[model samples]
Target: MHASREPASRSVVSDVVADCLADIDRIAREYLLEVQKIDDYAGSAVVAQDLEETAVASMELLLRLVGNLPIPDRLAGVSEALGHRRAQQGLPLESLLRAVRMDFRILWTAMLEKVPAEFLPDFTQDAVRVWEAVEFHTIRVHAGYLNELATMAQEKETQRAFLLSRLINSEGKDPQLLGQAARALGVKPESSFIVAVAAGHAQKAFRAGVLRAGVGQFLHERDGALILILEDVPARARREPEGTRAWLAALDCFVAPPARSLAAVPPMLRIALESLPVVTPDRPGQRTVRDAWGYVAATRLGEYGTVLADTVLGPLATISAHERDRLIDTVQAYLRSGSVSETAAELYCHRNTVLNRLARFEQLTSFDPANPQDAATVIAALHVHFLRR
Candidate 1:
């Protein structure tokens, strides 16, 4: 009877050990799996905390089951592994602590099915302290990782702003160099652009993705000051205009309260060159290259200058309106003939009146009324004056 009892006692010990290992393993694996699920879930930080609880509970049960076997160095390995994994993330320590407590509670509950009830509580409390230390270290590592990432993000933003500023300000700079610089900043160039410079009140008009540059009062010189390049759109029907009035209106449209003036690039290159010198007086020697855009700029400037000059002086000419009209008609008619009747009829005056108007016109414009060459000069002057206004 004594021999039989010894063998039965050994079997019981073997069965309990095997059951404790299987239970601990099943709990650890379930907790680990749950932690992974939480990592992918919405509000994963909270889930991560729950997972820590489950792990702590599993560890607690493992300790209780192996209590009589003595504490092994392998328990420390569990803490080390937890530290390494937690070091890779930025989760808060409080969440980990809560998860550790939850894991231990679960382990105690499961172990109670086989473990003597009285022993369960003491086992759990003992293992809880060890898990608490591991959780504390995990939180520290996560916070450090997060701080490093934030610093890196701020540095990148500062660098991007600096490079973009350089790209916008470097005029006549190499295209290849600009493209490379933009690439570094991840800015893509929009092809076929017009560079604009807005000044005054327009300076505050904020638009996302729109670059800003300086500009002056005159449309031509505006570009030389501050310039921002952007894509261009073809004029629509409502936006299109014809004749001098249309041209003047367009100019005014660009000259808003914020902007003293605005000029289209390439099409207004000549004006830009003249204005650029004045606009960028600090750099006086940078205007040698001229191509299609320059020609357009020159033409635009010439048109604008002609309009301005006419606006200031056109109404103040020496010849009166009535006299100038009569003069032109008489001159053209006289050049067409020496016939007095034809000249008088064309002027809507009597023959003698036509002669008198002719004399007065010649005196005023310094042209010989009867001479063909002098008559031609009067005609040319009259045409130019009419067009000027």
Candidate 2:
């Protein structure tokens, strides 16, 4: 009889409980569907955690609706859940705000079936304020994350640049790295090579340009020296006139402090390196470009030949090496043996001494003193000594 009397209250309780059950099912399904979409967007297996968290959130709301907690407590729980989800995503405030707004729209549509129409406005307004707080904190986290990433990128670039500079300046000097650097810099590495060494301490820049222009090859500079590797020329450049022109152009345009001297490898390289004018006393002046090359060629030959000659002649002679050299001049004057007196007069030498040196030369060479062939051989030897030294 007592249970029958409270039927209206009992029916109202049953209806409310059923509505809450249905609301829980709807929220769970919606949360699952939304989480799947987010997971697809994130493209990471980590998104599964966020999906589980969302499922937990829907369960919490369901418990709240069923009176497992007081209204205020339930609202706090929902706020905490939303904050956790936003933090997990590392989303900015604006993005979280947008997401929260969407959540409210969905919840409002679902609650319309159970919650009083008059209560909807107040509920949405309260939930939005809580979501705004969550958004603000999450945005700060997102901004910090972005700043860290930017700093990392800047540091990486700086490290890369330093390594590249060190590689360029290294002394071991890898050929591949040099070729790659030349390619990157738009310079040709393969070309006829030449070296123009500038003198004086202050004219380094002038030296650089001269060396670069003269070589027409990739230029690599070091302290007081520039090493040029010509990529264009083959292992041999015997007698190329065009190659010579290019070498000259380089010397003419770039060298400063005026290169006192230039040298190249391979004896035949002069076929190219020689075309360039030497640094004259007037530098590009001196109407007669008299082959200064003879001097260079002679000097190089003398380096080796002098050793051989010194071994044979000893240090002593009728006079000093210089005087002996002067006496040798008589050979040119005696082209046809005009007369010993004439040669002596030309050389300012004594007649008997000239005859004695001729006798000594014939003895050493095992040739007859008076023979024409012996005279010619003596002249040829003298000529080589003169030209090489």
Candidate 3:
């Protein structure tokens, strides 16, 4: 902003202000004392020098602008550097802006103290012009502050992604590396965690939703899948279960059962990825790898498992689909309960009905789901068959 269109009087006022530069150190000191009342900027020794420098820089810049003298590039450079440094420290931008806006009032006070009584009229004419200059300097300060914040945000995300990679790809043998990653991510090493995997196409939406859920801690997309790590669910999320539930249900992904420590996470991550193929459509909220463990193991067993399925379950294909489903469900329930009566109760049928189905299953497959010795093989066959279906 021009000091004045009326050059002579403006130059006289400008010259008067220029003569006041010798008192600048005192003025800057006063400015420091004044802002400290609102905020104890000196509390951070790292920024203590910055407080003094900011005060001095503002005064010098204003003095030059009033004199119509060339403002040094360093003045603007100092402003930008202040923004970058404060943001790098993760300090709020509000304090800097509040301090910056004080420059106008302080500049007026300095001029009032130094300018001779005769020059009062001339200096007074510049009230609007000086305010305009303060507004302009403030504009530069805001620009610098916002640019630095954006840069800091990007740097933090890059660091976060690097830490997540170390956690996911690191071998389980390195508990120390996991600890380091936990520290970097602000998560405790002992915290329970679950790993999840979804289609890569859902990556963008998943990222947006995870922020609201506030559960998932680490996220990244690899190959054709999006990997997400979940930690504590906030109380707010627990109260509004449906929001979080629906959010999770929409994620057609495999979520591994919760592991009690960071050391156990690598296995869970592998399990989540391994179970993805068996993930049925929208398994709804909080689905885990427990139910799909058999299928996941079967997938790894390759041809050996296919043969097991053919030998044990191939007979069932001869029967109607309805009968095959009923028998299979009964056998699974009987194996789970280990009691015919309990299985019948669970299936909401008579105890004799549970016995008949178990007998029928063993008759066809030559393995009894109720016999502990044969149950493992029976389950593996059923898993492989289910996988094939």
Candidate 3, 99-191: lDDT as tens digits: 778888888887777667887776687777668777777777778889988887688777777776777787656877887777766677766
- Each prediction's Cα RMSD? 17.7, 19.4, 5.5
Query: Order of candidates by TM-score, top first?
Result: 3, 1, 2
Worst 10 residues of 2 by lDDT: 254-263
Q: Per-candidate TM vs. native?
A: 0.29, 0.27, 0.76
In candidate 3 the C-alpha lDDT for residue 364 amounts to 90
Each prediction's number of clashing residue pairs: 19, 10, 0
Candidate 1 C-alpha lDDT tens digits along 258-357:
1111122333332433333221223322222231233234344455645543443343367676766656667668766778898777767799987886
lDDT of 1 at 14: 40
Per-model lDDT = 0.44, 0.44, 0.73
Clashing pairs in 3: none
Candidate 3: C-alpha lDDT: 0.73
Better of 1 and 2 by TM-score: 1
